[model samples]
Target: MKIANQISMKEIAKLCDVSVATVSRVINNNGRFSEETRKKVLDTIEKYQYNTNTVAKALRMKKSNTIGIIVPDISNEFFSTIVHGVESFFFEKGFSTIICNTGKSKEKEKVYLKTLDSKMVDGLICISGQEEIEASLLSRNIPIVTMDRRPKMTNNLAIIESDHSQGGYLATKHLIEKGCKNIIILTKKNRLSPDIDRMEGYKEALTEYGIPFTLQSIVETTDHPKGNFEAAREAIRQELESGRTFDGVFATNDWIALGVVKALSDFGKKVPDDVKVVGFDDITIVKYIETPLTTIRHDVEKLAEVTSKLFYQLLTEKDVLIKQKHIKIPVELIARKTT
Candidate 1:
């Protein structure tokens, strides 16, 4: 009786008098299909109430229409927004997502990968977690996409990342243009790809403008967005106590940038007049904040769209030479009150 209750895609296709692939396209709302055909299939689906357990169907057929997403911290607005973008695409394509939060722990990331592997997830979308272990997973023929960070191994991997170095260059260049000297930067201690590339861009800009770069000018935060407010506050407090002077500040991410703003406010300093600030990843909240942040903007939706298309192609197409190895999205500088 339980077996009889389970309906498959093939059954729907047969009932609708259409090819299984055509039915799949209609179900996923992909490609071109005649309106009459779409209505015919949807009506049949409505009549039979033919809801398939995608997981069980996938397991029986040796294909899981599901993917694993590993992120450093889901609470962070940047990562959360990106996850939303990825999920939206996958959901529209009749796939389920298993999201895991690692809290920036490599061990936790490894454990999650193992769990996902056992479940036979079709692919993985990793957002800036463990590198070495991820490379190992790729070696075992896992279809993986890395976002906001590059995987250590490039062979047969798809990377969706922003031009962080260009973003950093733009932010620092803006501060230099504002006639501000003695600029400081807030970043992560572990030096993830985003941090490392942004720092490089910052240094490049300073060098171009003939401003000397100092080691003391760079301060490391907790690398996690949740703790960054207090981290920035403390860093600023120490700098103030030690009488360090700076007229400009650049943050690796928007959260750290907001932290810098709050720290400056606590010190009774005025933005632009005392310390002009610029940030990376123009997350939504920054625009509505007390002082709208000046930031580098990259489209999360576009990144997800590209990633989803590539993943689908890899899953469907056996032609290895036709795939793109890397995708780097551009960044734009948004000038606002903070700058």
Candidate 2:
């Protein structure tokens, strides 16, 4: 006989002869559970007309089932992709995501942190940003996952990022193989992990090839609110006026590469014929640009997938964080017309 009244997960678990967690796994379509167990739980839930009151469940469990994401700029394709991937993963697991665009401001990041804390977010995901997150937030009982950004708290739950050092080395090495010497670096000035690692790789390649790393070989630009193009373009132009000669340029990002290309064009320089160029971040537009970019492809989707999986594991299995994990997702170098 079908039960007229609604029942709790405990009742469903008892009727299905399984644990409440198994019932929850079937309900959320998450975690591990046998197909036979799933069928039995569903059948029982249906027979009893079980109602899932998310609010009530959360109150009892002290889990809001909500996540917070902090990013430097949502407008940036890289940060946006990371946000989307994380949001999509959590949404599939019956959770809501609150994305905060900090505009690279430390003040805004702190404000957002306080807001997330007040809202009782179950977890937090931070993308690569310049500022360090406070130790208090990292010390919370909840899991914290960072992408390409290191938290001040050394023992934070997880840090998933691309292998930027390898990417930088590969980009530089490719330019070297293309017979381009006296290579220059066009990069942003933030000095973040990604930037530092990429530079490290670039230097490594130069060292192995018997090339000297000189201060004059580096040209730094800023991330203007609008874009980095104008800044990169202007910076390159200034470098040209200073009579700094280079047979190759390794831009840390594709947009900056575009600016570099435009700058070189203004000086009547031919790419590949006169100067070879390599860039990092194989964004979609790189393939369609006037000169296709030879660059490193950072796997945003894979980073998000790994970060979310690690977070969920930590959330469900409390003891999983016995050791801190810093996972680096591999990157690939895509050769194009630029090289």
Local distance difference test, per candidate?
0.80, 0.81
**Candidate 2 lDDT:** 0.81
Error of 2 at 171 (Å): 0.3
The Cα error of candidate 2 at residue 279, in Å, is 1.2
**TM-score of every prediction relative to native:** 0.79, 0.80
For model 1, how does the per-residue alpha-carbon lDDT over 1-339 read when each residue is reduced to its tens digit? 124356676887888889999877665444578988877776666556435445334434547888899988898777888888888888988888999999889888988887786566777888876655455543136577788677667655788788888999999999999998888888878777778889999999999999999898798775344587677777777787788889999998887888888888988999978899998888889999879999999877777778778877776676555346577888899999998
- Clashing pairs for model 2 are none
User: For candidate 2, lDDT tens digit of each residue in 133-210?
Assistant: 764643246777888887667654578899999999999999999998889998988778888899999999999999
* Clashes by residue pair, model 1: none
Q: How many residue pairs clash in each candidate at the backbone level? A: 0, 0
